[model samples]
Structure formats: C-alpha cells, structure tokens
Target chain A: MAAGKRGNVYVVVGMAGAGKTSFLERVATYLERSGKPPYIINLDPAAMRLPYDANIDIRDTVDYKSVMSEYCLGPNGAILTSANLFATRFDKVVSICDLRAQDYEYFFIDTPGQIEIFTWSASGIMITDMLSAHFRTTILFILDTPQCQNPQIFMSNMLQAVSVLYRSRLAVILVFNKIDVASHAPLVKLLSDMSLFQSELEGVSDFSSTLTQSLHLILQEFYEHLKIVGVSAATGSGVEEVISVLEDVGAG
Target chain B: MNVFLSLRSTTNHGTVLSPRRAFAPTFSMPYAQLVVGPAGSGKSTYCHNVHQHCASLGRTLSVINLDPAADEFRYPVTADVRELISLEDVMEEEELGPNGALMFCMEYLEDNMDDWLAEQLEGYMEDDMVIFDCPGQLELYSHHSAFKSMTEKMTGWGWKMVCVYILDAQFISDGTKFIAGCLQAQSAMLHLALPHVNILSKVDMLQDKSVLEPYLCPDHQRLANELDERMDPKYRKLNHAIASVMEDFALISFAPLDISDEESLQFVLYQCDCAIGYGEDADVRTSRDVEYGDEPDMSNLSLE
Candidate 1:
C-alpha cells in the first residue's frame, strides 16, 4: 500500500525504560554499518534527548514547549495535546517521508516513550495506520527482559504485547530485551519447550498456585505462533537474531 | 405575541405538571472490558489470569482475541479477529504489506463489529464476563477512539467493565522510572476515563527488593529530589511538575502482584473486585433467637 518501493517500516514500541531508544539506536547503527541505514523518524514530541538522528522529527511540525505554554499544560499533557495536533495534521509527516522517496529502504519510527501516546492516542494510531497504508510496517514489540524473569511479570508482558498486537493489527516480533542483565534464557526456554511447560501451563489455570500457570497459558495461547528472542542492548547479545527476524518478516 | 401569551397561560395553569408514569428500574451491567497498557505490559495475561481465576472459582469467562496479527495465546479464545481479517491476508490479497494490512484489519474489525462481534457475543449470558485481548498497539488505549467506541457498544449489551493497566515492576525500581511509569499510568487513566486498576506486575523477578523500597510507598518529594540528582539541572522544573502531578493525582501507585505468590494474586483479585463493586448485592442477615443466657449469672449469688 505504501508508495515507492514499499519501504519497510518497523515501529519499536515499549515503556519508557524498556530500551526502545537504545534498541532503535542499535538497529540503526547496525543497518548503517551494514550499508542499509533506514530513514529514522522521531515521533516522540516530548523527547528531550535521543541517541539517533531523525529524518522527520515531530518537533518540526509541532513545538512541545509552545503547546505546553499555550495550553498551560505540563510535559505529559502537552505531549498528548501535541500528538492530537499531529494526528490532525498527519499529512506533514507523510510528505516528509514522501520527500525521501528513493533514498531509504526502510523507515524506522522511534515513537514517544509515553506508551499512551503511542498505544492509545488517535494520532499514534493514525501515524501507524497511515504509514502502513503506504509502507511495509512490522511492529517490533520490546519486552524488558529483566522484568520477565518473574512468571507473573512475564505473563503481564505477554498480555501487553497481545494488546499492542491487536491495537496495531500488525505483524509483531516479540523481543525480550535486556537479556544481558536478566538472562531470559529460562523464560525463553520455558516458552519454547511447550511440552515440558505443560504442568506449569496447567498451573496458569489455578489462581491459587504459587507459580501463575494462567499467565503462562494465556501467553502460550496468545503468541503460540510467535517466536520469543532474547537480546541485550548493553552487550549486543542476540541483537543479530532480532535483526534477522526483522529481515525475514520484511522479506515475507 | 399571541402564541407567547398562550404558552404563558398554559405554563401558569400547572397543566405541564402531568402525572409521571412509574418506570421500572434497569438492572443490567455493561459488557465492556478495557485491557490497556504498553506493549508487553501484560493486558492479555491479566485477562487470561482473570479467566483462569474465575474458572478456579467455578465461573465461566470468555476471552475475545482482537489482535488480527496475533500468532500466540495462552488462554482459550472464544472469538478471534484474526479469523476474520489477518494481516497476512490483507498483505497478500490487497498487496498492502504488513503495516497497511494491520490498519486494514483494524478498520475491518471496526466495520464488522455488529456482524462479527455481535454474532460471537450472542451466545454469551447476560452477565457473562468477557475479556477482549486487545492488540499491542498503545495508540488504541491512549488516544484512539476505537476502543472507546468498542466500549460504548459493549456497554449497550449488559456487562460491567474495567480497565486493567499493567506496568512492569522492574521499571519502577528507580525513582525517575517510577515517576515516568506513574505519569504513563495517569495518562491512560485520564485518556480512557474508565474504572482502572494500576498493577505493578512481575514482582517475582525483582532480585533486589531494596531497589523498589522507595517506590513501593512513594514519597513524592524524595523521589523528585532523587530524580533531580540523576537528571540534568535544566529539567529540574519538569521533574518538579511531574512529581507534583503524581502526588496530586496519586495516580501511579500500584497494587503489587507476584503471580508466583498465590496470596499476592488473591489479594490483587480482591482489590480488583472491590474496585468494580463485584459482590455488593448480597442480603444482610442477623440471628433473631437468643437463649436466656449461655454463660449465666457470672457475678450473681452462684458462689454464695
């Protein structure tokens, strides 16, 4: 649906501390080093600082501080208002992307750290929808690996991932990030070895169990076909695998 | 002038005060369950847990998978949007690719709500608890009206609704991240404008409980100071504002849930029930019969 050569658009999504920016930086660096740097787009109007360069930054379209001053709102309120404004004038972003029609192979959107802006706001949806309408978009859902070490926490992460998958309605590649710190091997193995995890899976049905089996079962059922990959931004462990997944999804 | 005079005369005659008919009280809960959070924040997991929890207690609950691109699920789904409109189909049939297909799927789901969703929900009982495992798209919950419209439609059907917000507990270990988490949670609460429960999920993974000590019982000023210390001085004003809003709204403090601990899970459930006023309709009773005295005359002439 996207114009031009149907550029690959991967939106990296997660909470503020979920290493989205870091992951994007790594991916961009990797792509750049590999002679295929993406046209990076910064959709986070509230971001004070970022590690990567953006071809089309939301700040150029709407000044966050101006909105805050005009509306007498704080940063969060201003960001939401600005995002709403962006949704109304989404053509600007499209035009910017269109301007770079032939230069880039992929367009990477580094969204706002405010999850609500990216997940719940109409503007965020419009952005994703509009971009996808024109390009090949794959949602790269990042789960903080350190957070998933706990069974309950891991289940919660899966649910959130499912929610995003449904909301975005895009091909989602679930990435368990920060593996260097937390070592998500156990959780990844637990998920991969479905048969071995049957008892634990059954425990998800029993709310009274010490380990939550219901959470596991829900994740298992929701992402039965998806593969979970572990990566560490700090150590760059398993980053290549994630890139390969993206490449495969893009090719498909 | 003549019409105005006639209206005034009618108003003065008290004819407008007609006897009102006694209307029957409506007794139906709205069927809208809003599961919201960042991608990988555990909205679906919560629904599945709730379903399993209900089943354990001998209750029937159904989950509707609304993510078209969803490839996995740990809970049994009664309905799936993927069956109707998959991203792959959109890409292949329409030649739209992944993102375009995704948007198409969402629009298709929205358009077919009456036909597809209604048909799926038709078999459910009036009070059936249905949890919709929504997509990982954060826009839907934060600012999108799709879920809001969906909630409105579900409410029309007879279901009590609640928004279960899950935030990773590990992210809350630090003061700055805690503030960020709180701000995000508050934004969702305000944006959705629904009954919400903020959950600090994945407590079992916290290897060091001390890291979360300050956040567990948050002191806004202390947190602000800690944030000030960590962040650049230029953002001190912003930090103060955030801390103030957090304190004023009391928004981000979550009921910690360690699914690994059964007691923690139950406690979380109890809190959720209380939020929805789940069991407030039971009749109250008092025993009427009382024997003259079971322990009689302790101070009387018994010894004498």
Candidate 2:
C-alpha cells in the first residue's frame, strides 16, 4: 500500500449469513482457474468448516475451546482472546507469506462470521496492518442482495460499506451477493442515484430513515469512488469481476 | 410443572385464572423471550419455529426484529429496530466504521429504550408471549449493557423476561467446544441477570448424535479426558481447569432443540416458561382439586 507491494490481499467481510464462505469458495475456484493459486488464511478460530483449504489456519496455532477453559472465557470471549493470541504469533504468518509471496499473486483471507469480531478486534487490526504494509490490500465487503432490498436495509448496508472502506483505508470492492435470490439493480440505483434513493427513503419514515436520507446526500461522493458489482455465490456468477476489480485497483 | 398446575385447582375458586389462561383475552402482564446466540446459531430460525409451534397449538407469539440488517425472516415482525436507527444512517452520519456504527445503533436503542421501546410495546397486547430475535452480534449480550438495561426496564414494567441462549448443536458436539459454549452462556447469564436457558439448537442436523452424547448429559470426566488428549501438554492444566469449572459449578446445561419436531420445540418453550415462573402465580380454579393431594386420578378428571 505504501508503494509497490508484491501481491494483493483481499479480506472478505460481511454480516453473518451473507454468503461470505460460499463467496470465498467461489473466488478460490476462480483464482485456481486463472492459474493463480492464491494463498489462503482462515482467521476465524470458531469456524467449524472452511469451504476452501486455508494454507495457514489460526485453528492450528490456537484452539478456541482451550482458550475458553484455560482462561475461563465464554465462547465469544474465547474467540476474541484466541484471535488475539493468534495475532501475537502473526508475525510468523506474515513471514511465511513472505516466503510464498513469489509463488502466488493473490492472498484471500476469510474472516469470522460476525464482521465485528475480526474488524473490531486487536488481532484483526494487527493482521490487516501487517499484511497491508507488504501487500496491496482490499476489502471485499459482501452484501446479501435480498437483505438490502428493503430501502431501509439498503441505506444501512451502504453506510456499512462506507464504514469498512474508511476503516480499512484500503480500496473496497462492494459485492452484492445472492443475486439468485434477488436482483441488485435497485440497490445499485439507490447507491449511485441520490434522487432515486431519496424517493425510496420517503416510503420509510422514522428518525432512522430521515438520517438515511441525509446519508444518501452526504455519501454521493463516496458512491462515485466505490467499485460495486453483483454475484450469486450459489451460481458463481460475477465472481470473475471481483478479480478484475482487484487487478485494476492493484495496477492503478 | 403438573404439580404446580394441578395444585392450582385447590388455591382460589371460580375467579382463579390458570397460568395458561392468565393473560388470555384480557391481554395483565407480558412475558417475553430474548433469543440470542452466536452468528448462524439459529436465533431467527428459533423464532420462526416458535411461531409455527404456537400456531399449531392455537396461540400467538409476537416476533420483534431487533437486528437492523435482518431480512427474509419467516415470522411476522411486529416491531423492527430500523424504525429507531439504521446501522447505515449511523455509519454515514458519523463516518464511523461498521462495527462502531453498529455499536452506536445499539447505544441509541439503549438510550431510548424507555420511550421508543415502550411505544413499540404499546401495539402488542398485554399478557402477550413475545420473542425478540436479537442480532447475532456477541457484544450486545456478552458484556454490553443494552440487553441488561432492556431487561431491567421490562422488569420495571412488571414483565417477566427469560433469556434463551442458543448454541449450534455442531458447536457443542466437541468437548472443547462444549466448554466454550458453557462459558459463553454464563457470560450472558451474569450480564443480563435474568432467568437463562442455554439451548443446543439444530439437533436435527447433527449426523452422529453420539458425538454430542457426552455434552447432552454433561459428562465431566469424558470431556476433560478428551480435552486433555486433544490439547497440548502445556495446556493440560488449563484444560482441566476449564472442564472442572463447567462440571463443578454446573453453571450451564443445554436443552437439545430439534426444531423440526413439534414436541422438541414445546419442551424447549416449557423449560423457558418454568424458569420464568410463568404459571406459578395462577389462582386456584376448583375446590374439587382441593381433595386431590399427592395425585389426581387421571381417569376422574373431566375432559375440559
């Protein structure tokens, strides 16, 4: 990110049940097809099964349940604590990635189910910082299309996207997932056309919606800078575009 | 439970209302379940299952969507948080990150709980059975004050609140994961300070029920032995320490929920009801049952 990084780091994040795992799996396949076997990392200690085989998994170095019993922490605390412990040893992970940096062009990191667990955690901050220092990092912020169909939910989703974009300080690729369930055309319109969003916001009136209208106006510039696309993780449609966006941003 | 109900026959005569019928029709005090769990743990699914379960039994349950990002919920949402604050508005308005924005949304909900929530509750009838399918965000229940303050408010309003903490059946199938689940449940229990029920949800999806058998009964020795074998020798003491806490204090035990099975759902709800003392305050309905002491003859009871 500072200058010319060797490779790209794509951090996939979203609300729970937004098809993050499936999307990552599809991305892995797309990468493999392009002859770029991306280095994969699973940062979520509590995840039971990973759709893709991660080259470096936090589970190997940290046991979530052991963290709980040893530290007398609950499941969530153990997750955050385990992630923190894993973060301490993350320099080694970065070194390992460094060794493989010449062999792979892309690195895909699958985060935990809850977006905040990783994004708001100390380990998450450290890992991302370490990776970005050596790589051109981008956040693949996934939004479940159906969840955003409601004008209210869509406004919230965009605001969430802007938050991630600003926080990561990395180029963001807004991904509207589950297109098979719902079309993302309306969501695209709401994000790009402030007037259209205003009309839709009129139907949902509350303190929140009024604030949402103001956000629609304020985020008009943010909309101009973001790269958004739709893909059905189930069908694997539009997964290739994610890679293209990364390449374009990574090149620029 | 039967004893408590059958004893109701002896307490107060004709005007005495049974717990099952206590709030019916008149719509006196409200009872609610604050459904919470880790991500993908079926908090929303449980609400849907309960809605269907109550429907078959000719009862109605109101579902309040407390998650701003919620969509495609199976149950009808009576009240939604989007009315109060959207996570998007907070994010755009404040230029905070998604996590920080969500925290703001929750804090906003907490700040206005007395008024906004009270107005939200005005639509629901008194004595209603309500379910709050909360966001899967662990922060809200683990250490946060939103749910705790909301619980306090409801209690202040003369409402009976029960905290239903759900863990995935697959999550608890392993000994190590079981300990984690127990500790997590205890955190919410301590934080909310309410009657709590830790449930092993999605039991129907577990392939090998035997893997979860040890936890189903909470076998301390087997879990510790497995934990000891699975973890490194350096953590051997820590494993024993955690397993011992789970077993000794017995702070948590799980009720298995095979949501697909109607009986399983009923059993889970019944456990929650008993925890809240749902029918303990019902009045005596009949003098005939006053003669019944240790046992009521099953054959002598009228069908009604």
Chain A (candidate 2) TM-score to true chain A: 0.94
TM-score versus the correct structure, for each prediction: 0.49, 0.51
- Candidate 1 per-residue lDDT, tens place, A1-252, comes to 333536678888875557888888887888899998888888888676778888878888899879977977534456777878878887777777776757887788887775656765557778887877877888888878876654534544555565565456566788878888888778777765655555544543223332233334434544555756778887787878987887787776
Badly placed stretches (over 4 Å) of model 2 are A1-98, A101-252, B1-28, B123-126, B281-304
Candidate 2 per-residue C-alpha lDDT over B193-241 given as tens digits, one digit per residue, 9 for 90 to 100? 6888888888888787666656766677777788677543544554555
Say which candidate scores most in lDDT: 2
Interface RMSD of each: 17.5, 18.2
RMSD to truth, every model:
22.7, 19.0
CAPRI verdict (incorrect, acceptable, medium, high) for model 2: incorrect
Error of 2 at A221 (Å): 53
lDDT of 2 by residue, A1-252 (tens): 356567777888887668888888888888898888889999888777788889999999998868877987545556778888988998998888888888988888888767767654556768887988887788888888987776655655555565454345566788899999999887777777867887776765333444444455435655666788899989988878877887887775
